[model samples]
Each structure stands twice: as C-alpha cells, then as structure tokens.
Target: MKIVLASASQFRKRALDMLGVPYEICPSRIDEKAIRDNDPASLTRKLAEEKARKVASEHLDAVVVSGDAVVSKAGRIYEKPRNLAEAAQFLRELSGGEFQFVTALAVMHSQTRRMLSTVEVSDISFRPLAEGEIQSYIEKYSVLNYAGAFESDAVLFFADRICGSYNFVTALPVSRLIVFLRAQGIKI
Candidate 1:
C-alpha cells in the first residue's frame, strides 16, 4: 500500500523522512480555525485525526498520517504568529517560564478506516530573556512559521530545559509514529 502524509509542514515532512518510507504529500484542506475545544489535548487530537481522515478520504488504498501541535502556558494556546511583532511578543511571554508543548499524531488505514492516535506532551522552560535577545532572535530567524515563535534554531539556545522528546518540539514524534504505522501493517 502507498503512504500519504497529510500536512504541508516542512517540519513534519523532514521528521517523517527519517523513517525511509516512500510516501506522497497530500495536505488536508480542513479549516483548522473552525475546530474548537477547551482542552489542549482534545484540540490537537481532533485536529490530527481530522487531517488524516480528510486525506484518507482521497486515498482509500493508502495509509494516511497526520499530526498537529501547539504551545501553551497557563491554559492559553499559542499557534504560529501572524507577523514579526507577534512573534517577538510570543518569545517574550514564553521566556523565563515553562510551557506545555503538545503534539498529537494520527494514522489512518484508509481502506479499513482504522485509525490510531496518540498525544505527546513536553514541558519546555526558557531562561529569562532580555528585550534585545528576543528582538535579535526574531530578526535572525523566521519565527512566524512555528508555534510560540519557536523555530528549530531556537530549541538549542532559547530553551533552558526540555522534559520530553525533542522530536515533539521540532516535528512529529517518530518513535510513537513507528508503532502506529506497524500496527497498520506498514513496515518502516
């Protein structure tokens, strides 16, 4: 059976490539903003499943995989910033504090509609950052593409501590994804 990745995110694509599985990219066309849930875990899980289902519908013979992630602190969720200003603000707010990084992964056997989903939560803490530091980081990287303005480059220098899988922070959690794919009878 063929495999399909249900997202346009380069981060996810890069992570999936590590498995060495040949797959096609078929980004889901769902309106993510329309999906609402008070709980962070539920929100990410639903989004992940929805993306997989949306793509699976178009490729019934293939295994469709999808994922969604968010960075939250004190219950407020932070998605990708709209511009440099918001990116800088996000960095400032996340600095000197620990936040929850939630990643939800889903795999669907389109032929059978069998779906497996899991969530990985990581605690990330950043040391206090100065205004100049935040400004410098924002100017140096394209932080608009990632949640909490956390580009991959920021992971090493900005984050003071990480309590979970680094893959969850940078992209999809491949270890968990490997198990999900195997259960769907797809050899990685």
Candidate 2:
C-alpha cells in the first residue's frame, strides 16, 4: 500500500526507515491546540487523524500516517524547544530527572479516511548536567530538531539510561508502527 508520512520529522523518517518500509513526508498543518485537551492517547490519535486527513484529502488509495510525540513530566508537556535558551531550560529541567515519552502513531486511509492508532511509551533517565554542557550541547546539536531538544549527538550523554524504545523517545516507535503496517498488509 502507498503510505504518506504526514510529518517532516527526520526522526520519524529514520524510524520508518528502520522498518524497511517506503514512505513519503507530508506534514500536517493542523492547529495542535485544537485537540490538546484529549488525554495522551486521544491527543496523538486526533493529531494523527488531522494530519493524515490533510494529506489524504489530496491523495488516493494511500494510507497517511501522522503522529505527535512528547516528553511528559510533572504534568507538563515538553515539545521541541525553539531555540538554544529554551533548549537549555528543557535540559535543565530534565537534568537528573526521569521522564516518560509518549509517541503516538496514526494510520488513516486515503479513500475511506478510516483510522487506527497506537501509543508507545518510553522512559528516559537524565544524568546530572552542567550549565555549560547544556549550552554546548544545544549549540552543537540543535534541539529544534526534536521534542525536548534531544539529539543523537554528544548530548545523548545526558541520558544515563533509557527503558523501552530509544527510538520512541526520538518520536516514532518503529516496532509498534511495523505491527500496524503489517496488519494493514503494507509489507513493513
């Protein structure tokens, strides 16, 4: 089946690549706040639905995929930091703290607009980070690329350990997505 990745995230692209499935990016431009009130699972599902809908409306016979991943801590949702200062703040808040990452995946058909979803949770343990380290990491790795300003550069040292899919922490859960694609006979 033809699949469209309703996101331009490199992390998500990489995740899909791991599954050996072919997909194309088609980021959704929906107002995320419109469905923020929903719980973690529903929030992701709705976001995915909206995103996939955006692309599906313009395509035919394709299943569009959309997702939203977040770092939830102390009831606060941490998304990708916009700049170095905010990225530093995000790292500071996460320093020596343990937090959970919720990666939500959605698959919607192009013709029927039907949807299916899955939420994958991953835990990350942050190491004690110094101010200089955070600043340097931001300058070097660019947190704007990921939720919570995380990257695979030297900044990964900030994580002392991780439980669950490290890939999920980045945003997309390849393992869970594979199952969904397989169920749909996508040959993932």
Candidate 3:
C-alpha cells in the first residue's frame, strides 16, 4: 500500500524514517491557526485528523498519516514560536515548571475512509533556568521550530524529568505508529 505523510515537519519525518519504509511527504495546506480549542488534546487531535483527511482526499489509494503537537502549562497552550523573541519568552515561561506535551496522530485509509486517531501526553519538568542559559540555548538552536521552544533532546540539558516516550516530546510517537501500520496490514 502507498503511504503518505501529511506534514512538513522534520521531526515527524525523522521519526517516520525509523520505520525504514518508503513514504511520500504531502503537506496539508490547511490554515492551522484558524482552528482553536481550549483543550490541548482536542486541539492537537483535530489538527492532526484534519491534516490527514486533507491529504487522504488527494491520494485516494494511499494511507495518509499526520500529527500535531502542543505544550500546555498553567492553562496556556503553546505552539511553534513565531520568532526568536517569542521563543525566548516561551522558554522563560517553561523554566522551573512542569508542562504537558500533547501529541496527536491521525491515520486514514483513503480508499476505505477507515481512520484512527490517538493522543499521547508527556509530563515534562524543567529545572530552574537562568537568563544566560536561555539566551545561549536560543543562540545555539533554532528554538522557533519546536513547540514550547525546546526539543526532545533538550531533556538531557536542563529538564528535570520526563514522564513519557521521548518521541512523544518530539511530536511523532513512532512505536504507536508502528502498531497502527501493522494493524492496517502494512509490513514495516
């Protein structure tokens, strides 16, 4: 069966690469900012499903996969930062605090319209961060590309703890995806 990934995210692409299976990248052109929900889970799930469905419609014979990720803390939801300043601000807010990283995946079989949606949440705690450290991190990495201004491997630097799979923080959850593909009769 043909496989399609409905996102332009490098992180998700890298995760999918782990499967060692051929897939096509067909990013959804949907306006993501137009969709909003107070609940993080609902927001991510909807975005992922919408992306998958859009791409599926274009490739009727392929299985389309898509995902979305967000970080929520103190009732605030954070998506990818728009610029360096916003990235720094997000990192500041996440400093010395606990946040929930929510990632949702949607898989659709375009031919039959069979779909599956799943959500994963990771509890992350960051140690107290100083101004210099945050500045240094911003300079060293492209923080704007990641939700909450941090990457999965950032846990090795200043994160105090992580309570879920690293791939969840990266926004892909490959192990779960493997199971989903297997259930669809696709051999990886």
- Model 2 has an lDDT value of 0.75
lDDT for 34 in candidate 1 is 90
What does candidate 1's lDDT look like per residue over 117-159, in tens digits?
9888889898999999899998888788787788667867877
lDDT of each: 0.87, 0.75, 0.88
lDDT of 1 at 50: 96
What clash count does candidate 3 reach? 0
* Models sorted by lDDT, best on top: 3, 1, 2
lDDT comparison, 1 vs 2, better candidate: 1
Cα-based lDDT at residue 60, candidate 2: 78
* Candidate 3 residue 139 C-alpha distance from true site, Å: 2.0
Instruction: Kindly list the per-residue Cα lDDT of model 2 for residues 1-188, writing each as its tens digit.
Output: 68888888877778777777677777887777666743665666667667877888877778787788777778778877877788889889989899877778887777766777877777888889999888888887857867777865533687787787655534766667777776665775
Q: Model 1 misses residue 153 by how many Å?
A: 1.9
Q: Candidate 3: where is the Cα deviation over 4 Å? A: none
On residues 118-166, what C-alpha lDDT tens digit does candidate 3 reach at each position?
A: 8898888999999999899999987887888888667678789889766
| Model 1 segments more than 4 A misplaced | none
